[model samples]
Structure formats: C-alpha cells, structure tokens
Target: MEINLKNIFIAFLKISTILLGGGYVIIPIAQSELVEKRNWVTKEEILDYYSIAQCLGGIIAVNMAILIGCKLKGTKGALTSVLGMSLPPFLIIVLIANLIEKIVQIPNIDSFFWGVNLAVVILIYLAVKEVFLYALKDILSVFWFVLILVLACLKVNPVVLILSSLAFGLILARFKKEVKDE
Candidate 1:
C-alpha cells in the first residue's frame, strides 16, 4: 500500500491514543500495525529506527514516528507524524492533570492501576524478547550483547555503551571484509 500523509497521521494518532506505559511498550504494537498489518515497513526497519531512536534525546515513540515518517514521505511527513504522535498524549495529560487526584480516590482505581502495570510489564517483556532475538544473530553479536548487558547492569552510561558498541561493530565489519577479500 502506498503510505500517504493521511495514513501516516492516522496510524500514529491511533498508536499514541492507546499507548500506555512507556516507549518499550510501543515496540510490539508498532510491529503488528506497521509491519504485519499495513505492510508499510519491515521488521528490521522498525527495529533499526527504534534502536536509533533510543540513542537520541527525546521520547522514543515520537522519535520512531519521525524516523518512519521521514522515510515514507519527507519533512512534511515528519511534521505530520509528530503532530499525530503527540496530540493525543498532550490532550490526555492535560485532562488527567486536573482530575488525577480525584481519580485516584475512586474505589478499585488502585486495582486498575495494578493491572495496567502488570500488562505493561508483559508488554515490555515481549518487546525485549523480540529485540533480543533480532539482535543476537551471530556469535559475535551474542558476545557483544552479553558484554553490553553486563555493562548496563553495572550502571555504565548508555552513551558509552552505544558508542563502544558502534566502534566494535565497525571494527568487526572491517575485519570481516578484509578476511573475505584474502
């Protein structure tokens, strides 16, 4: 299907509307919608965009929308994607801000939040599983994954982890090319 501005906007708007928890929860939904259903993007493409998005400053979901939008259309697509991705959340936050205190006082609200938290955890697990499987495609990748996981657990800065991973990947690629040419 030819993805146009309207489709881009609507897709992101829908994603943003039901998006609870954080950016990690977005992975499976985006994969299903854009990759499986719409056929607008590939699994690898979404994963690549998502990885890059995480390394950047802003919200990961919005970063994803911008990257995918730019890929599909261009500057206008990026703007439209941002508007779609942000509008619902902004309005919802505004509405919730006023009523959050009272809303929490209601009976069963605690249970509701508890359930939502559990669901978010499951979603996060699914997202992590997907990315982990995608990333560990080789022995070298597996080595890097374990090393990085250890570094992350030890509280190493994410920027250092990312840069070092990039450097490692480049050197590995260069070595592979030189070996292949021999």
Candidate 2:
C-alpha cells in the first residue's frame, strides 16, 4: 500500500479512535500498527520519535504522528496526521460535554473507568519498559538512569530533568570524544 496523505490520515484517525490513556498507551499500539503491520516506519524510528515527542509541547501521539507523517510525506502529511489524531478526541469531548451530568450519574461508570485506569497502567508500564531497554545500553547510561530516577523521585520538574540531561549528555559526549582523540 502507498504511503499517501489519505492513508496517513486514516491510520491516525483509526489510532486516535482506539487510543485511551494518552501518550504512553500509543507506544505499543503504534509499534504494532505503523512498524510491524504497515511497514511505514521502523521500530528504532518509532522509539526516536517517541523520545523526541516527550520533549515537545503538545500531545505525545500527535507529535509522534506529525514527525512520522512529515518524514513520510512532508507538510501535507503532517497536517493530515494532526487532523486525524485530533478529530476523534474533539468529537468525544464534545459528546461527553453534553452528557457529562447524566454520565456521572451512572453507577457502573465508576467501575468502567477503574478498569480502564488499570489497563492504562499496564500500557504505561509496557511503554516504560520498552524505552528503558532501549536507553540503558551501557554503564554510563545506567548511571544516568539511576541519577534521573533519583531526581524524579525527589520531585524535580520534568522540564528541568530533561534540560539537565541534555546538557550533561552533550558534555559527556564531548568529553568522550576528546578522550578518544588522545
């Protein structure tokens, strides 16, 4: 199948419809669909896109879709992807807004949401596991991993953590290069 704007839109639209629990949940589903099933992108590319998406401002799935779409077909692909990703949630929110009062009154809804939350937790765990395995390739990475986990537990803001990690990673890379040259 050709990787065109229409396909990109449809893929994201289908993904957005089934996606729950936001960005973390997108990982496995996207990997299965875009990488394994469609062959539109690679696993490594998805991982890289996911990592970059985390640093960006908007939603993770949408950011990822844009990056992949742009890589595949440029600006039109990106626009199409965003439209696909956004449309479902927009409509769902509008529908919910109209029925929220009645929806809240349903006794079984609490149970339903609780089950969904549990599933989301599992999805998040899977996403973290995939990223963790990809990231911790060496002793230095492990060191940074521990350090970052500590900082996160200490309640440091995520933006600060990411920025500091970027700075330190650059410095370490430069230092490694200089040492190798010697």
Candidate 3:
C-alpha cells in the first residue's frame, strides 16, 4: 500500500482551514474530503474511525486525523496530518485566548455562534445518517441498531451498550453457523 505523507498533510490542511465548531462537525467534512474526494478511505472505514474516536475520548477531529493519517501513510503520515489539522487552530487559539472574554460580549456574536451551532448540528446529523445507512447491512445489524438506539435514548451506559452489541453479534454469528451446518 503506497501512501504519501505530503498528500495526507495537504488534504488535512485543506480540511482544517475550513473546519469550524465542535469536533463532531468535522465528520461530514472529513467524509467529503477523505472518502468522497480523495478516495483515500471508504465511507465504512471513516465511520469505523469515527466510532473508535468516540471511544478514545479526545477531540473527534484529532482522533480522526490520527486514524486517517495512519491509514494513509503510517506514523509519519499521522504526524503530518495531526500537525496540518492542529497548527492553524492552535495559533488562532493562542491569539484569541486572551481576547475571548471580550469577544464574547461583542454584538451579535452570540447569534452568529448560534447559527454556526445549528449548521454544525446539521452536519453531524448528515454524517450519522450516512453512517447508519452504511451500517444497516442486514437484519441482525438492523436489530442491533434499533436496540442500541432505544437503549441510548434510555440513557444506558455506553460501555455496557458496546459490550452488549459485541455479545449480540458474536452470538448471532455462532447461531448462523450452527444452523448452516445442520
């Protein structure tokens, strides 16, 4: 598998320049650029990365950077992508940090952020819809999806949900095999 660190850096840099809002908002953007445009990874692959990102508990975009970067060009690629995605934001944050308190009081700033937040919500929704469509590949998957959705709505612990899903899948696979062999 050939991978170029430069391309990885360039792609992530382009992505970061336009990114805004919470890290979750990066999902659709990353999908558009990495999976759809660059074809560096598949939709499923990126979704998997996103899921892993959730489990890992850092900024979603940064976790995604590491995953996509490693997938594209190993460790060096990961480093390049991380730097590309982080550098500008880091600089901007440093510049803004001292002034953020004052900026928050600016007229219409709250409303502007409110609009941006709504757009980010839409972006996150679209990304989840795409991932759900891809993941609903079979009856078993559908069952788990619905089950997890209900459990999540009920506020079940995520760790338990993950474990339950793993058990369900494993049992289903075994049952299918047993029936097939009979």
Candidate 4:
C-alpha cells in the first residue's frame, strides 16, 4: 500500500501528542501504528531504524520518524513527519515552561513527575526488550549485549563502547562468513 505524506504527518502528530511518558512510551504505539495498523514498515525494519537512530546523535523518536517517513515517501514525508512530531511539543513546552516549573515546586506535582519518571523507566525497559527480541537472533548478538551491559555498568565511555561493539560485531560476522565459505 502506498503511504501518503499526510498520513505520515498525522501519525507523527498522534504519537507525539498522545504518548504520555516520552520517546520510550512511543515505541509500542509507533510499532502498532506503523507495523500493524498502517503496515508501512515491518517490525524488524522499525527495530533496525531504532538501532541506527541510537548509534547516531539525536532524539531517537524524531530520527526514527524521519527515517521511516523517508523510507515510505521520500523527502516530503520526512519533513512533514519531523514537523508534526516537533511542532506540538515545542509549542506546548514553550507555553507551559513557567507553569511547569511552578507546578513542579508543589509537592503533589513532584509526586506526579516521580510517577511519570517510573513509568518512563518501565516503558524503556519494555521497549528495549521488544527491540532485543526483534534484533538479537543469535548467540553472538547475546554475547555482544552482555559485553555492552558490563562495559556500561563499569562506566565506560559510551562512544568507545559503541564503536568497539560495532567493530567486534563486524569482526565476528566476517569470521563467520569466512568459515561458512570454507
């Protein structure tokens, strides 16, 4: 099915507006909308876009929306999706920034934010699990996950950690290909 630019923009607007917690909260929603509802992208493609987004420097959701849009309907889709995703939040934050600061000073508001924070953590965990299930298909991927987790826990520089992991994965993949060719 041909995905229209208007539909892509509307999808981003809906996701950005309704998703309560943050980027993490948007994952399942995006997956359901893009993969299940619209059938614009597959689950595996979404996961791949997510991985690429993470490895690059930017907001994951915006990057993902742009990538998915570009994949579907080229440059126009990318621009509309990004605008849809960004404009509402930017305007709302600007309007409410002062009010939010004042509200944050209130005890109940603090508690509310705390709850939201916890929900964000849970959302991230679930999103990560979903991504892992989609992306990690073999023992080598599992090993790389463990290695990165350990390194991150040890406070390793993230850039180095990511580069090293990529290098290791490439080397292992190359070695596997050679062995298969023999």
Q: State how far residue 90 of model 3 sits from its true place (Å).
A: 1.1
Model 4: lowest-lDDT 10 consecutive positions: 173-182
Instruction: List candidate 3 stretches off by more than 4 Å.
Output: 1-3, 166-182
Q: Give the per-residue lDDT digits (tens) of candidate 1, residues 26-123.
A: 78888877888889887778888988898788778889999989998999999998999999988988889989889889999889888988898888
Give the worst 10-residue stretch by lDDT in candidate 2: 173-182
Residue runs of model 1 more than 4 Å from their true location after superposition: 131-133, 171-182
For every candidate, C-alpha RMSD to the true structure in Å: 3.1, 3.2, 3.9, 3.4
Give the lowest summed-lDDT range of ten residues in model 1.
Answer: 173-182
lDDT by candidate, in order shown: 0.83, 0.83, 0.82, 0.78
Model 4, residue 142: displacement in angstroms? 1.2
Better of 2 and 3 by TM-score: 2
TM-score, structure 2 vs. true = 0.87
lDDT of 3 by residue, 50-126 (tens): 77776666677898899888878788889999999988888889999999989989999999989998998789888
Q: What tens digits encode model 2's per-residue C-alpha lDDT throughout 104-126?
A: 88989888888987998887777
Clashing pairs in 4: none
By TM-score, the best candidate is 2
- Model 3, residue 106: displacement in angstroms? 1.8
Whole-structure CA lDDT of model 4: 0.78
- In TM-score terms, candidate 4 sits at 0.81
